[model samples]
Target chain A: MALIKDQQLSCSHAATPEMRFTDWVSGGSDAGDAVLANGADDLPSLLAQAGKLSMIAIEFDTFADGRGFSMARMLRRQGYAGEIRAVGDVAMDRIDFMQRVGFNAFELRDDQDALQALQKIGEVSVHFQPSADGKGPAYMV
Target chain B: MYAYNEFDQTLIDQRVEQYRDQTRRYLAGEIPEEEFRVLRLMNGLYIQRLAPMLRVAIPYGLMKSDQLRMLAQISRTYDKGYGHFTTRQNMQFNWPTLESVPDILADLAKVQMHAIQTSGACIRNTTTDPFAGVSADEIEDTRPWCELIRQWSTLHPEFAYLPRKFKIAVSGSSSDRAASQVHDIGLHLYRNEVGDMGFEVLVGGGLGRTPVIGKTLRKFLEPQELLTYLDAVLRVYNLNGRRDNKYKARIKILVNALGVDAFGAMVEAEWQLIKGQELRLPEAEIERVKGFFKAPDYLSAMHASRDLNDTFAEHPQFAAWYKQNTRDHKQAGYRIIIVALKNQLQAPGDVNHQQMDGIAALADEFSFSELRSTHDQNLVLADVAQRDLFALWLKLQDLGLARANVGTLTDMINCPGLDFCSLANAETLILSRQVNETFDDMDYLYDLGEIQLKISGCINACGHHHVGHIGILGVEKGGKQVYQFTLGGSASNDASLGKTLGRSIEQDQVVVVIGQILDVYVEQRQTDETFLQVIRRVGFAPFKERVYGTHQRSAA
Candidate 1:
């Protein structure tokens, strides 16, 4: 139940490698540190620092914003094995899609029911394409 | 026809259970009325002004004999023993109770069919040329591609809540019987310069208050990139399509807002990011879907025998039917036969349980056990041998399925209108009956030749009046039904929206107006010129002056 402000993660607040797991990762932690960003361009650097990352969150400004899904998929493809959580305007309908694209955790508002959100993940019985879960064949499979 | 695989079957089964739960919740007051309304519409159940109507998708309008029989059985048990074939190649049952819809869906699921996305804002039942596999002029059969789109678009999570409904049509034949240009997305299959089969994609074409022909967005989209390109298009529309005003909310408005070049550029930009990605259809997958649509083992029969020609010459009814209802099949000695649903007394597109069973049986016996529903609301037996047509005709006559009015005036495309549709502003079935009664001569109709009479109950154009040769639109004036006429529309290769002829007339004057137009055509037409040709040649002036001259004088 973590809250993510819209523009907290910036180049100025970059997290350093020395930062420990318990430290706050948002703006107030420190400035001029190597903080994590969630855009497609940030995937390579984030994968390079995968072990020290306590948490990685991607922003979905709208419910139907799917670029974040691809960014998460790229993270998984580049072997960033960390807690990738989706933040911002995510709803019950988008949980399964986020999961399919390799978001291990989600941060929703406290009023939202987590159980119903979890049920949405179980809606699709099969996936036509392979993704971060390392399941399903490539196109041929 | 593409038979459903296990995955398809399971998904529909799950959908039925899901809808059943939703229905139970709605009836039990667990969900509020407004919330339940969206839920029911998503499941293709509409609580109309009268009773509940359920539209079942007939995927590209192709059906196995067993599926048709199941529909007939459902009609007898759950409905009023009849179903209406819709303009989008689906069937609507007008009398199913809300409580019984889940059972009806369950029955549909059992036959590898469901009512999913048929009436929703999401991608609806994908329609293609009714004669896809059998048409002689086809570059490639478009059924597999339609089936692929059907799978990809069913209950697609992101596109489920669009501003308005979306329709996609594909045409493989040169004649464009699917009316591709008038759809939200119209795909015309053609061969590129290097002999590669692909689609010329058109977007933003629709018929309603504003009817615009879809402009070509892609010159050639290869077979595999079809879905990914469509994904790009739908995603663009979902994200940016107008949502504020229902009138300007269709994807057409968005396409018109952004000129075709800018819209195509946006779609191309989106597609460029995902073109060769997972959504790109793999070669194996294309073959996997295409394998299901391989042509039936047609009997290697050659010429129509002297006996068939002799029979035609002997019987004028048979001759007229042969000229009209029958079409050339790809294989030699085979004929594609249309079982016209346009009987004189019955409403257009109405096929009862008995007729459905008869068609199913006939399809099983003569048509490779398959049937097709045309965009024109006629049933086709796609692979009947020419020698067997006489035998098929006798069996069809016994079942009353052999009306032999495929392209005649009686073969009108009339909407349910005020009769069953809640959206209808005026009564179309009454007007249709008047037209049918007035033009009862088969010989005269055969001479008139290939006239399309499309009637819409309202401006919604559900009956496809915009593309009809003689479009009749029913409007309401002073709380009574009035009919307006449009001339020179055609849905074929030379597709054009109809031009409105003068004033709206009372319901009783519909037949007289139609008669006067036909009289004008007879007087002005060159030899063998059809109604549409005559109207196009004369530009509706003579007919307009003849029908409305006195009215103009009175008004003056």
Candidate 2:
């Protein structure tokens, strides 16, 4: 239930409250509900609604399931600059990589310590490749 | 060897700490075992049947003397004083404790090595020809590109969690020693008509339950476009590859389903968007990485000596070892010696700490303080002067490494099957020993010429049995070990999967079956024709008839 933004504890602010991925995709009556996308949701259709959404949260069904990372990256590449939050099975070890792939806000699993996870976000000082962070690859740097 | 810069070192150190935290959390019951499994596997720790197995990555099979010594030290300190070399050009320590794996990775980090992506459903250690730079047949040195890909794939954020484990191999030689055809992404470096270096990008080739040869996605990808193209290929696989069924998750299955042309088009569409992005390899970075793999300063006057020939003349055993175990190097008077780890007495690719230390010393004295691990589960001293061949052979002989069967049938690539691996359905080491004993004569093996005999305890094909000239797969039926044999497969320039000869046979009959097959080859062979060439010429019918006899074929 904790939200972390830019490696610090943050409060959730959104135009539309949490909506299930299925309800968001079913063309529901609620037009302004900030949607939650499943890891397996179709990206192009999701991106089509990017302009209307205030925020979009992606669910990692399992921590080992990495389809969400690619989904987040695809969302970012498609020019969705809204708050992209990651929820479910989120742990401290995966924060740095998740951040690199464009997950700005993390709704970690209930067990993870929000403060401890913050320290882990910047623990890895260098990354070998360029990512959503827009920092050049370490080699170019 | 490619020396790690400060950035590379920092990343590894951070990774070690991260894994340490994960371990502590998992041990503290904060992280569940199922979630922690992938985390540990990404760091190259696998909980095995007997103990925790740690796979240490050796990028492109290159290692320095100090690094090899560090591995020996780790084996002595952490495991049972030995390590196993794998067909993917990595090392495995089979006796590590689950609690101590993070500490082992820290130790590896001190020597600029890490097990990053050595296993798991991620891009693995990028392997290349062991004789990469020193091979006379090489069009270009491939280690630099392997290093680039290694860095690109290391902790890659988006592609980390794929449907299945992915493997990539590179080769710059006309001869396909790296087995490029059987990898998820195979990069074959070559010069175009105008002398521009590029790669023929092969996609979706792999060995497993559904083995398929990689198809060429791009006929030639420019050198600068390698990473971007690779990124596109991986992205396509990650998003579109099947995740519903674990068995059908590998890119090979997707490539077959989508068809190579459609897959290539998808990758092309993706690449067209990211082609000139930051992932492009800058000229300076390419040159900087290439600098690490430059040729060593070989003595100008080094040449084959008359005294060495005289010594060889006196010692017939040394002569046999030199002729069979050594390969011609590009540099004059230099030879690449394959330190055979497949001696009949020792387990395939298992080297004791003592042997490791001795090999390190040998590398320092004879091979410019550098060594390589071949995909054949053997080590190589790639820059030995021809005049030092006698001395090197004698030293290797002292260590029981001079098997003189480098390319022979006895030098088989085998997996640590049911003996160590939890996934293996049957035993591999026993069958390996039986086959070794049945074909122990070096003279006969030499006459038989080059043959690749590979065995796997399961269909996962870690031993690459699918691509072996004589492939043997172990299966458990009715609580008994049964083996299936195939013939005519290869991992060379003309890579092909072997066809099954017939029905599975009992374990006790494996040796006799192989013997019968070789007998057929010997009976029908022309002069200088190898076992593979003979099989290709006569087809599998002749060998199958002899091995199974006429009655067994109709036994429905």
Candidate 3:
């Protein structure tokens, strides 16, 4: 069980590297690397060293603080090909919003069940507009 | 008075089906709760702390008597026999179940009304001068243009998902009754020196957390190119508006960051590409909308009759009401009567099922069977006969809708605050009651004269406190309600933002504080100086000194 801290993580977390899920995918490390890759200085260098990183972690200090959501979108639009994992204060209420902006996995807070959060994320049946993941079929033109 | 065409009808009908489908899917457990929350809000359905509230749009505050009766029937059938008219000139029913909403939409559709774009980050209703067609001073009737914009923006594909909710208001009158300066887009219609009618377009004005006066983007946009230019402005905002922070997402912030000149240039550049394109209003279409709003055949009787003067002398109350609520009409022997919804006891804009029916009946009797909902929450019977004034007054008095406080202090503009609104931080209705009770003396209110008191429950400024002559903002401090007051705001031709008078006071102290402020005004004011003029001349210093002085003395 991943212990998702709700406080905003330091800038060093964005620079950390992780094990590659697929060689074809080239981006920063997954969000899980924040805990796995310890210390501040090594994170950015590790992110630079990865030839095909597939995921990255970002923290939301509070449920209302939406800075992390923007950070994830900026990373995706800047051509970072990776899974953006949302950690910290990521609840079921915010899952659809996070997914719309391009977050793939949400590490739930300690008190909340991850399985329930995942189920909640899968339950969205309709979307009005295209998201960071891709444009909707209706908007493909 | 602009009638919906087939295209407009079809669009609303389609939107109803869309909402119905979404509701069905939610109930069937296909869409998750959180996702459905956003979807339902977009459809103007809010699950309040108590029950489901449905907000129905009263576009540009114009409604036929039939429409008003339909609302009354809907309230009786679907809701709790009452509907609350909102600050935005819309109406909200507090107790509609989720299951009954589709039925409500169906009912509203029967009367050519729907709640589409009433909520969500879309182009909301295009509000305008309530006295649009009937105002003696109007440059042109703006209802046709408002109706055109309504059709154009309803479920518009490209601009649906903007950074924030957008509002546009237009004024045909030089007095600025529509509060055009405080809207997302404020358009003042005028005929230039060459006798060609155009709009003086103002953009980026809003009243929420960061209240701003809209800047003039176009000094003169030709009537035909209005929609295209508006589209260009919206496109610029849609693509570049900050979506990350909801607080900084309004077009005002974007316009401010870019500077007005650069923003106007960008809009002009975009307009150059699309000006002669598909969005331009066709001559036939413009005429078709205008045909519905042509002035009715009014009798050419000049001056008041002996009967009217006799009635005035016989009835002082009726005379006072006439003096305050009635306005000069363009046609001789005709007047525009405002039915004041700002009565003392009831919520500012709440018209009961019976009152709604009565108003509908009254509209049928006078005013060419048309009624308008002003932004200040009053209903206007815009073509009253001079001979029928006394009779109309008597009937209106019977229904408790004949308050003479048209633009007076007691004619307060307030939101449904904590009593019905979930977003409210404090109870605005109670504060309104307190203020009303404290200033119940009609003579005192008349003495003060034409002061606009606007209160908002929260920082969203739905009650338009930023533009009030005396603005009271309800803030929550440590789980308790506190009232903050601002002075010198005006939403008329000379629009200005209110300045904070002093520190926040407790809820109970609001009425007394307001009284003290009024006391200061009375003491310092010169003869015939209005509340706004006095505030402008003497400044907030005297009022602040009095209010704070009383506070310190009480503390000691």
Instruction: Compare the candidates by lDDT and give the number of the best one.
Output: 2
Error of 3 at B487 (Å): 0.4
Q: Which 10 consecutive positions of candidate 3 chain B have the poorest summed lDDT?
A: B299-308
Which candidate do you rate higher for TM-score, 1 or 3?
1
Clashing pairs in 2: none
Provide the lDDT at B359 for model 3. Answer: 93
Query: What TM-score number comes out for model 1?
Result: 0.87
- Candidate 1 lDDT over residue span B261-375, tens digit each: 9999888877887788777888898898889999888776655422577888777677777778899888888888998889886888889999999999999888888998888
For residue B251, give model 3's deviation from the true position in Å.
Answer: 0.4
Candidate 1 residue runs with Cα over 4 Å from true position: A1-117, A127-141, B303-306
Give the chain A TM-score for each candidate.
0.64, 0.85, 0.58
What does candidate 3's lDDT look like per residue over B40-146, in tens digits? 77678998878999999998888899999999999999988888877677888989999989989988988899887788777898898878887789889899889
In the range A1-141, model 2's lDDT, one tens digit per residue, is: 788887779875543246765677686635546788876777767767776776788887877678888888877887878888888778777888899989998887888888988998868778777888886565555
Candidate number with greatest DockQ: 2
Q: After superposition, how far is residue B437 of candidate 1 from its true place, in Å?
A: 1.1
Alpha-carbon runs more than 4 Å astray in model 3: A1-141, B302-307, B553-556
**Predicted structure with the largest TM-score when compared to the true one:** 2
